[model samples]
Each structure stands twice: as structure tokens, then as C-alpha cells.
Target chain A: MKASDEERRNDAVIIRTEGLTKHYVLGAETVRAVRQIDLTIERGEFVAIMGPSGSGKSTFMNMIGCLDTPTAGKYWLNGQLVSDLSDDQLARVRNREIGFVFQTFNLLPRATALHNVELPLIYAGVGSKERRRRAEEKLELVGLADRMDHKPPEMSGGQRQRVAVARALVNEPALLLADEPTGNLDSVTSEEIMAQMETLNENGQTIVLVTHEHDIAAHARRQVHLKDGLVEQDFLNEPVETSA
Target chain B: MLLFEIVMVAMGAVRANVLRSVLTTLGIVIGIAAVITMVALGEGAQQRVQEEINRMGTTILTIRPGQQMWGGVSRGDAQLSVEDAIALRAGSDGLLKVSPEQQSRMQVTYGRYNSNTQIMGVWPEYFEMYDHQLEAGRFFDQGEVQGRRRVAVLGYNVPETLGGTPPELLVGSTVQIRGIIFEVVGILEEKGDAAWIRPDDQIFIPQSTAQYRVMGGRDRLNSIYASTETPEELDQAFAAIDGIMRREHRIRVGEDADFNIRNSADLLETRNEANQTFALLLAGIAAISLIVGGIGIMNIMLVSVTERTREIGVRKALGATKRAIMTQFLVEALFLCTLGGLLGVAAGYGASELVTRMAEWDTSVAPEAVFTAIGFSAAVGLFFGLWPARRAAMLDPIDALRYE
Candidate 1:
């Protein structure tokens, strides 16, 4: 079967890196947080970066999410070279191309769920009406439509994480980056978030998750383990079945 | 649209910390209130001085007796007589309208009611010089002054003080001044107070009547008033008066005369200058308070930025540019100051009203003062809000996100 042009574009690689490295100077000692890591994440793929303490998984995730620039490396997101982009340009890249789900949920406590979801759109200069419509649609998609007006403090851990997922998806970014997203949740809530992420991956959303939990990493179709600032192993895995 | 969102975000942040925000704005409020109230009082005092200058006749010069010296030794007193006034009137080439005045406090009675009143003796021209209007009867003419007629023009309140008789009824009636009977020819209208002079409470009569009949034939006059039609002619009138007075007093040329010619307008202008200086000094002090208030805003804004560091990190991660973050905080500071300015203006207006009611002082709140007060407060916000906003904008997203 011949795929259409849009399908071919969708099949293209979403992220490519060559010798991505990051170093932090702590007084006199130089700490190499991420070193000589080469990785690629294709469209419609779910990948988990797993590591223990003192590993470089978090630093790698930060560089991939466009929150930090690699000290020495070439990196591209959706075929655009973004390794040396200025701070403001990188912010734009993060806004348009990457959606971040931090471990802390990172939702503004004072804003409603709907408002939290609408934040990226507001930064994108969307009109209020259209922004509200898209935010509502995303919240509904995450099964939080009835709790749209609820604040983060008023919601459960699972519900707040779902709101974070909704916010991450609201901009329709090319890649979703979740860093220890289930770290603060109980096992049941973590399972629920992982199922939701699996559902999103099944629907052709590219995702890169960072976690130290083996079971959480097991949910991804591929796993890359990092040790001491280098990739120790990279392999594929059979996706875990979702009960929902 | 983005700007609007940012402004709303700033407003939400302020609303979240209601007590802190209110306490932060208190400094600006008191500062602006002090500025407004002080300026209002200064402007009010200036206006009053201007009114006094206008009322006292700007073109009029009063010639008072000065100490006469013989080789720098003091003479007990020098005199200005009716002749000096007549000489000024005749020799000024019709440039001056002159009147000699002699006043004494005396008891006046009418219909068994008596009151202590100020009795002023002068020419008919005195009424015109002071812009005195009559409520009833006619002013005694020059003929009455030459004839030493026992006719008087009562001031507006004289009738009320003398047993509450009406002005029109008092005119054409006989009243005794120092037990001497005089006919009331006219009643002057209410003139209000002008500086130290209260024209509304004195009784005016012919100069001859005062000198020969009431003042025990005293020939020494108190002072002579000379006026020019226009302010431009005042200098010429002054020179003429100086020459004429020197000749009348028989003093030599280039020697100091035994009299001083003071332009009433100049005296009032000096007083006005002093009033303005005092007002400006007060306004300056008030402006210092505004600066101190601005410093307080800056301090609070710094604390707010530090407290919201994590929020700033989240916003930056969500695609907020440095300019956007800067604008958000700046708008917050500006909003707080503008709000304080408005409230301060209200409080200041109330304070000025209170002063007017309690102290009986005339206070005019100029519209310009209101506008300037608000504008200055906004500027204060902008000036003081810059550093905190810059610090917020310069924050590293990763560090901020990691801040505990």
C-alpha cells in the first residue's frame, strides 16, 4: 500500500541527535551530566529513558525538551537544527514543537484546569474564544471536562496529572516530553497515567518519557537505559496491554 | 490579545495576595495624598493673595510718615498733612488721585443704641480708589469736604452693629460720633476683608470734619493715598510725588524725604512671593514622601518577584518570552501605583474639604493637580518597577524551575 504525502511526512523522524553532551561546572570540579549520547526518536513512537541516581536521564530529557542547550553536540527536532538556537528562539521551539509534563504536574495553583490548559495557547497569541474552545476540547479528551473549573489543589493526584496531560496536548505539539511524570503519584494513579499515555501513543502521538521506575518504563514500546552520563543499553520492548 | 492575557495574569497575582498588595500600595497612597493636599493649600493661598492685591488697588501708592533724621539723629515723628495730599493732586499733571486719611476708634450712638466703631475721615475720592459701592444714598461730594460738613457714609455692617437697623433706613438719619451729631448720607455695600483692611466695618466722613470737629482740631494727617489710572502711569506718579513731597517738606534734593511711597501692589506681590516659597517648600517635602513611597513599592516588588520565581519558571517553559515576563510584572506595579494614585486623590480632596470647613481657609483643588498627581504616581511605578521586572526576566528557566 502506497502512503499519501501527509502519511510519509508523519512517518519521518521527530528527533535526531549526534554526540549530545552537557557539562556543569561546580566550583573546581566539572560534572559531566550528559555525555556522547546519540539517539533518534521517530514519529508515532513511545520511548522511555530510564536511569538510576547519578545517571544522565534527566539532563538528556531537559536537552531534548529544549529547556537546556547541549554543551557540545548537533541536535534537531522535526528536521530543524535547534542545538545552537538562542534562548528566546528555543522557547519558541519548545512552545511549537515540544510539550512538557513535569513530575510535579507544574499547574498553576491559582488557575482553573481549563485556564492551565489554555496557557500555551495564550502564549501562542490565540484569541480568547478559540483558545477556550481548544482548551475545553483537550480537557474533555483527558476525561476532565466536568472538572474544568477546578484548581490543582482541589483535584486528586490522578486528576491533576490528567490536567497536565491535557495541557501538554493542547498545543498539538510534535513531541510530548514527560519527565518522571508519575514520580509523585501512587501506583494506581501512575498506572492510570501510563494507560492514558499509551492511548495517546496508539493514536499516533510521539512521546519520550523519563523515569527510574522499571514498570513505568515497561509501558513504552522502546527503552534506553542511561548509566554515568552515557547510554548503557538501548532496546525494544513489547507494549504492556491497557485494561481500559 | 497576548498583552491583555498578561495583564489579567498580573491582576490575578495581585488579587491572590490581597493584604500584601494593599500594604504595598499604602506608601504611594499617603505620598500622593500629601502632594495633592499641600499643592491645594499653596494654590489656595496664592489665589487669596491675588484677590487681596486686586481689592487693594494695584495702582494705588500709600505715602506714610517716616522718621525724620538730622544728621542721622532721630526725630520723634514726621507728619503728612492735608496740604501734602493737595500738593500731590495739583502738581501731578492730573496723573494722581489723592486722598488724605485720619482714622480713630470712637463710640457712635443712634436711637439709644451705641457701638464702638472705626471712624475714617477722607475725601470723596477714597471711595472710588477702594472700589467701594453704595447700597443707599450718595457719597458726600468735594463740596462737603471743603465746607467741613457733618455728613457720614456708614459701612455695610455699621447699621447691624448699631442696633440692627437696615442700611436704607440708616441713611438720612442722625448718629452721634464721640457725642457729636452727624447725618448718615450713604451706606456702603459689603466689601469683605482685604489683608489688614476691613472697609465693611468703618464709617467714612469729610477730612475737614474729622480734623476740626472730632479730632480736636489736629492738623497732622495720618497718611496720604495717591493712585494712577493705569499701572503704566504709576512710575511717573511716583517720581512726581517724590519731587512734590520733597518740595512741600522743604527737604533738599538727593536727601531722603521724611516720607515713604509704597506701591500697595508691590507690597502684596512680595507677600505673594513669600507665600509661594513656603508652598513650594512644602510641596518639595511632599515630593520626597512620594520618592520614599516609590522605594517601598520597589522593595515589595522585589519580594514578590522572588516569591514567584517558580511561577516565572513555569511561564517561561510554557513559551513566555523575557519581554512578556517583564511586561507582566511592570504592568502589575503600574496598576498598583495608579490605583493608589486614584485613592490618594480622593483622600486628598476630602482632606482639603476638611481644612476648608474646619479652618475656614479657602482651598482650591486645581484640576491640573489631580492629573499631575496621577501621572507622577504612574511614573513612580515605572521608575521603581524596572529593577524587579528585569531580575524576573533575567531568571534562568532551569534554575527557577528547580528553586525550592
Candidate 2:
């Protein structure tokens, strides 16, 4: 039987990079932020990019998240080339294909949790009712059903992070990108967020997490470590049994 | 749906800084209020002038004596006499109704009440020329004028000045003017003040009675009034009066006539033009204030954009387009300006009402003026909001996100 379009796209690589590079000119010298990295991640895979502060992981993540254009080379998200897209087109790609969860929980501080979760759908041109419904579902999935009306300032740090997670997932994007998601959380809350992400990966959600902490990187099924603007290690980990 | 979300976001941002927003709009409020009040006052003055024009007949002309020049040497003021008026009336060929007038302020007494009042001496045709209607009794006839009878016609407010007696009751009563007793033959209905003429407060008497008895035989008329049946006939009447006056005074056609003829309509039109120029100048000053107000809005909007830099970065990272960001800021500015406009209109209307009540001046707040004020304020919003909105839209998301 001929594969359906959705099935074909699901089988295709969710993210592919060919010699991706980014450089910044600091007066008299050029700084190579990300240098000649070729990478690929298939649908439903959980991966973590681990690096020290100056190891170029943030720059690589920004390029992969469609937040920054590369200085050289190609990037394909969901089988479509996106590295050369214009600023506005990159915004559209971010809205439709990639979901972002930030360490600071980047939810609009003044907006209620539900409103914050509905933002991506708003940019996706979804109807108000459908946006609310999908946002509610995602918030409920993140155990924030009772806190949907609370603003970021009114919520606990972990709860705000969960709200950010819900916001990131509400658009049903092909890739979920989390950059230092548990950076500001307590140990227990960080574990809680990581376990939630692990559950999401088991449910066939493709995830890419960026972090400097080894414990946070351990939650992903595979890990890639970077140093000096180049990948130094790529390895898979055995699934750790949950306490529950 | 996106548009609705954008509008909501803008509303939320404004609400978040309610005090700042209100304070920022104060300039626009004062500017629009000034514009509205100034326009209303100007319009009221124009309406008053129009009413004055209608009150003083547009088809009537006043003949006043100008300086008489002899062989290009300056002479003192010339005189217009009753005989010159008679000559114009006779030579008009049924095209003009002429009246010679003499007036003075004199003490008038009725019983125990006495007041200083204007006494007017005019021909019997004067009432018809001014279209004055009688409230009671009949006007003095030509026979009365010819026989020099001491008959008077009371003006609308003359009864009030003389002990507040009713017009109907005072018509047949005798009033002493300058120590001469005259019977009131008629009372005129109210005629409002028109420019220099206050006909409602003056009492009219026959020109012969005034010349022989009241004015002590002074034949020099103050001025002559000439009227045509239609405004279209004023030019012909003017030429005929000029010819007759020249012939009576023994002046040739090529010489400058001593008498100057003035059309009341033209004089009022000149006054109206001056009023309009003054109104425009005031409005121009008010418009400058509006522009100053627009600059104030621009200054505040730039501050807001700078303060909300991180918020803008978050929105952009969450997939907000440049157009969306621009629209958000623009809508906030537009909303602020429109709110100020509405408040200003209300304040201006209240101020105009206060003026009418306290100063007794006519003021009308036209709906078009209100709408134009609001529309102009909105335009100010768009014009001044552009730079700040553009600055917000062009921000790089990575740099903005990292903004402290």
C-alpha cells in the first residue's frame, strides 16, 4: 500500500543538518560559534545536546530551532529545507513545525497560563475555540488543569515550567525543543519535569533537549556532547527505571 | 482570530500601565479640547454676524456726508440736509423709499419714572423702510409729519424704561421728551440689537416735529436711508441718488461728491470676513497644539517600546510576525488617542455650555467638529506611532530576548 503523506513524513528525518556553521566577527577576530556540524534525528527520538558554556551547543540549538540562520550549510526540518528561509518564513516554521520550552519559562508574565498556552495556536491561525480546547488539553496533560487561570508570577517555579511545556506542545509541532528546561528548578522539581518529558518521548513525541547538567542529560535516550565548537561524543543510554 | 488576539494583547499592554497611558494622553486631551472650543466660539460669532445681516436690511443703503473738497483743498466735514433726501426721493422714479433721520440721547419722563433714552426723528416712511411692526395703536401719518404734530411711536423696550408699563397701556399716554410733551401714537414690536443700531430702545417721532420743536429747528439731517424693493435694484437706486445729490449740491459729474453712500450688506460682509480670519488664526494656533500633542505621544510610545523590549522578544520567539508586533503597538496608540479625543469633546462641550451660561455668548458644538477632532487625533496616533512601531518590529529576536 502507498504510504499516506503523514505516514511518509513521519518516516522521514525530523531534523537533518549538513555542515551547519555560525560565526561572529568580534572586531579584529572571527569567533566560530558552531563549526561544521552534520547531524540527524529521526521522528520519536529523544536526544539531549550537552555542552559547557563555550562549547557552541546554544548556537547549534538556536540554528536548529529556526531562531537563527546559519552562516553556511543546509538544515531540513520535517523533510523541508528551512536554513535559507526569510525572517518571517522562519517565524512561520517555528509556529508550525517546532515548539520551544525555555529555561526561564518564557511564558508571558501578564497572561494567564491558559492564554500563554494558546499563544502558539494563535500564531498558527487557529480559531479561538479550537485554540482554547487544544491548550486546555495540553495543560491538562502537564497536570496544570487546576492552575490554568494563574499567571506566571502567581505560580510555583515548577508549575510555570509545566505551563511552558504545555504552551510548547499545544500546536502539535513535529519537534519539541527544550533549552535548559530545568535550569532554575529544585532537584525534585527538575526530576519531575524530566520525567514528564520522558513520558512524552515514550508517547511518540520527538524531543531535543539542551543542557549542561549531566543529570538532565541522563533523562534522554541518547546524548551528544560538544566542545570547542565541535561534537566530541555521541552515545545511547540504557533506559533508567522510574521510581514509580 | 489572529487579529482579535493581537487587539487583545494590545489592550492588555495598555491596561497593564493604566496610569502611564492616561498621563500620556493628557496632551492630546487638552489639544483637542482647545480645538473644539475655539471652533465652536468662531462658529457662534459667525452665526451672530449672519443674524445681524438679516436684521439690518440687505437692500438698504445709508448716505453719510464725507469731507467736501474745494479745488483739491481739504475742507471740514460736509453736511447732508433734509432737502437732499427730498431730492433723491423725487428723482428715484419710483425705485427708492427715502427717509432722513436725526437722533440724540435725551431725558424722557413718564409720570414718576424718568430715564435717559434715544430719541429718533425720521420721516413717516421710515417705519416701512425698516419693516417695523406695531405692537399696538397706529403709526403717525404723513399729515401729522407735515403739520409738525408732537406724536411719538414708542419702541419695544421704551415702555420698560418708563416705569415698566405695558406697551398696550402706554400707547395713548403722553411722555415729555426734552421738556416737550408728545402723545404716543404707536408702540413697535421687539427688534434685537443689530451692529450699531438698537431700534428696540429708541422712540421715534416725525422729522418735522423734531426739527421745529425737539431739535430746535436744526435742518441738518444726521443721515439718510434709501431702500430698494429688491436687492437687485440697489445699483440703479445708488446711481440715481448720487445724481440727485450732486445736482442739489451744485457739483459737476466729474468732481468728487461730498456725500458717501454705504451699502449695509457690504459693510456687514466686511465685518464677517474679519471675523472669519480671526477664527482661522485661532484654529491654526490650536492645530499647532495638536501637533505638539502628537509629538508627546510619540515620545511616550518610544519609551513604551523600549520598556517592553523583552516582551516583544518573547512574542517574536513564539512566532509573532513583524506585522503583528507593529499592529499591536499601533493599536495601543490609536486606542489612547481616540479615548483622549472622546474625553476632550465632552470637556469642550461642557466648557461651551458654561460660556453660554456665564458669559451669555452664543456657542454651538457641531457634530462635524466633534467627529473631525476625533479623526484628527487618530491620524496623529498613526503618524507619531509609526517610528516606535517600526522600531519594535525590526528588533532582532535573539538580541531582544537577551535584553536585560
- The candidate that wins on DockQ is 1
Q: What tens-digit string does per-residue lDDT give for candidate 1 at B269-294? A: 66567657756776776688778878
Q: Report lDDT per candidate.
A: 0.90, 0.88
C-alpha positional error of residue A108 in candidate 2 after TM-score superposition, expressed in Å: 1.3
Question: Candidate 2 chain B: minimum summed lDDT over ten consecutive residues — where?
Answer: B270-279
Docking class of 2: medium
lDDT of 2: 0.88
Q: State the lDDT of candidate 2 residue by residue for A1-244, as single tens digits.
A: 2553454255568988878999999999999999999888989999999999999999999999998999998888998889999999998899888889888888788899999999988888899899889999999999999999999999999999999999989888899999999999999999999999999999999999999998888899999999988989989977777642
Question: Model 1, residue B272: displacement in angstroms?
Answer: 6.5
TM-score of each: 0.88, 0.88
